[model samples]
Target: MDEKIVFKPIGYIKSPFEDVKNMPKSTRESMDVEAEMIINEEYLESMSSMEVGEEYMVLFHFHKSEGFKQRVPFMGNGPIKGLFSTHAPNRPNPIGVSTIRITEINGNVIKFNGVDMLNGTPVLDIKDIL
Candidate 1:
């Protein structure tokens, strides 16, 4: 039988971006944006080996996105296409992944840049990418 897998959020992400419409479509060259991750107390120990100026892959869930359509209009374009092909927030799982630059680290909060998620988003995991 296939094994079952379960997961829980390790923390929550905070950002000035309160709405999806206000966020940019991409974070490639956007350096002015900023965000923070308020990690849970239980996961504090795991951060000991981490350091400043390192990058991490933040996996999070878009809790506010309720439903999804198979085909969505692309950036107000003409026809609808598969949701997976676009970065639309509406999805079956609504999981978002973004690589951000670590600006600073407090006791349980991490400040970073290149944020595409809205405030209050639950962070599933944080992995060192560099």
Candidate 2:
């Protein structure tokens, strides 16, 4: 039998954008956007050695975006294309990645900028952007 897939969220993201529709299409467009991630206790030690001014690739789960379609309408255009061709949230797995600069790190919270994710997103992991 095929093995079951599983994941444990290491943190949860906090962002200003509550509605996905209000968020800019990409993080590049939201230059001044900021977000905070509350790392779970189990993962706090993993971030104990991180430094400010460094960039990290944050992997997260899209907790709110539901359902997936093989084809979707794009940019208000007429032709429908495969969902893989675009950044639409509908996917077999709704994981997300965003690179952001680390600004501050408290006991269990890490603050960063260059945000595109909606509030309360589950953070799967973080890695150096290099």
Candidate 3:
């Protein structure tokens, strides 16, 4: 029997980026953007004991990228490569993962930096990187 799995976002990501075209042309090191993780009420309790000045791995869904391209040109390099081999947003499962530095934490909201996701993206999970 074929089985299917589904997932619901535990939170939402808020950022200054409104469109994917405006995302930084470079990776994490070159971007100094700020963003926030507004977690759902049900997951608030799980954030307890998380300290300030820490980092976490954020997994999120790129709801905007719907079509998949078999090959695309690399961002910096000018050669076309398979979608899976490059970090192009288009994919079967457009999930984005990034490690960000926690700037502050207030209640269910986590303020952070080094954000690369578009505004209102659904966050799948957050893992402490201690």
State the C-alpha lDDT per candidate. Answer: 0.82, 0.83, 0.81
Model 2's alpha-carbon lDDT is 0.83
How high is the lDDT of residue 60 in model 3?
82
Which one is best on TM-score?
3
- Which regions of candidate 1 fall more than 4 Å away from where they truly are? 1-6, 74-80
User: lDDT, candidate 1, residue 116?
Assistant: 83
Q: Write the per-residue lDDT of candidate 2 for residues 1-130, one digit (tens) a residue.
A: 5777799998899999899778866668765877899999887789988888888888989888789888987632447888877666767789878888888899899988888888988999999866
Q: Number of backbone collisions per candidate, in order?
A: 0, 0, 0
Q: Rank the candidates by lDDT, best first.
A: 2, 1, 3
lDDT of 3 by residue, 1-130 (tens): 4677688999998888897777764437424677889999899889997777787888888788878888888863569988777777778778777888888899999988878888998999899986
RMSD of each: 2.7, 2.3, 2.1
Query: Please, what is the TM-score per model?
Result: 0.83, 0.86, 0.86
Worst 10 residues of 2 by lDDT: 72-81
Ranking of predictions according to TM-score? 3, 2, 1
**Model 3 bad stretches (over 4 Å):** 25-31
